[model samples]
Target: MDRIKEKMNSLRVEADESAAKVEDLQKQVKTLEQENLQKEHEITSLTHKNSQLESEVETLEAKVKDLKTAADDGTGHLTQNEALQRRLQLLEEEAEEADKNLRETNDKLRQTDVKAGHFERKVQALEQDRDQWESKYEEMSKKYSTVQKELEDFQAEIGNI
Candidate 1:
């Protein structure tokens, strides 16, 4: 009976531990969601910048095309056109690199979401296990009480004899 009580105590401790672990995991998931929000904000900013750069590049390209269509053989116009073309290329590359970075950031956010989901599942399972352990502990306590009462009744009868 002493061993049974000891085991019950140990199970109660385990249930407490499960509760603590669930709290910890919930905190981690909250932190991860916060971080993901920040990253999304950053992605939005980068996307806006990329769009602005693309518009500028498009305008520059149109101007260059118009100048070339005019067939101006002047060296200065040619030089200016060449410079504009080079600027457009550089802008396009910058936009491409920014897009690539945005893709990578999105991938990272998805992975974080997956991890958060996993943590949540773990917390749920732990909570259920804790509940089961508590139920078992309660059942054991009732049994122990019944057994103690029976033992007391037996002692009383012996004393009467």
Candidate 2:
């Protein structure tokens, strides 16, 4: 019947639309995954930098302590002691700068974590939607096949008559 053809055409259009949407969702998921991976790498690099800065600060502190001990032990000229004091001041400044950098890196790491979490959730939702659309497309195809078979059988009967 004409009505059956109309319904089949409509089903076909719906199926095609669902397929396109599924593909688009899949692409979005892929892009999000790539972004998430990039964020992870950035996090790792920042962590490494943070560790290095902490180590540097510790080393500088140890050097300052050693220089103080030397100055107090009276094992050098007065000029040598003055030079050591200046050097200590510069080392302390460097340590302070390193501490500041570490704090900034930690903040950046936290922000990256939040962004990664958001992208992961988005990817999961998109995947779920794609799965549902794929299931619908399969069901539509089966129904279309069944209807087409029925139509063929009816035509054969008509031809025989």
Candidate 3:
């Protein structure tokens, strides 16, 4: 009777430990799920931003083409000084546009760099979490096997009695 009570107490303790482990695993799963959702949101935002940048680049290309055509067409009709002044104005405008484009491109590049770094860190963190979970699972498996063997030995002893 005392041995049976001991076995019951042991099982109770194992059950409680298992329940706690299951709860902890559930929480880890929830955390990983939240991280996945955040990553999806980031990907969506980056995609939208990439599309906007592509549209802006197309618009800038059109503007450049239009300016070049206008400069070519206007050159033939002007006197030398007028032509020189017009050319200078067009050059100045082109330079300004180029500078503006360069600045915008640099800003976008910096933003992309920042996002990439953030993503890398998140990935590293996730990998660490996965490794920890795997290690815990291995430990749990070993513990379960040990408990099963002990239970079998107890059963055998009880049968002999």
* Residues 21-133, model 2: lDDT tens digits: 99999999999999999999999999999999999999999999999998777666777889989999999999999999999999999999999999999999999999999
Off by over 4 Å in 2: 1-76
- Compare candidates 2 and 3 on TM-score and give the better one: 2
Which 10 residues in a row give candidate 2 its minimum summed lDDT? 70-79
For model 1 the local lDDT of residue 84 reads 99
Candidate 1 lDDT over 1-161, as tens digits, reads: 88998998898898889889988989998999999999999999999999999999999899998878666666778899999999999999999999999999999999999999999999999999999999999999899999999999999999999
TM-score, structure 2 vs. true: 0.48
Backbone clashes, candidate 1 = 0
Work out candidate 3's RMSD over C-alphas: 70.5
The Cα error of candidate 2 at residue 109, in Å, is 0.8
Clashes of each: 0, 0, 0
Candidate 1 accuracy as lDDT: 0.93
Model 2, position 91, has a per-residue lDDT of: 99
Candidate lDDT scores, in order, read 0.93, 0.93, 0.93
Residue-level lDDT tens digits of model 3 in 1-161:
88989999888898899899999999999999999999999999999999999999999999999988888766654566797899999999999999999999999999999999999999999999999999999999899999999999999999999
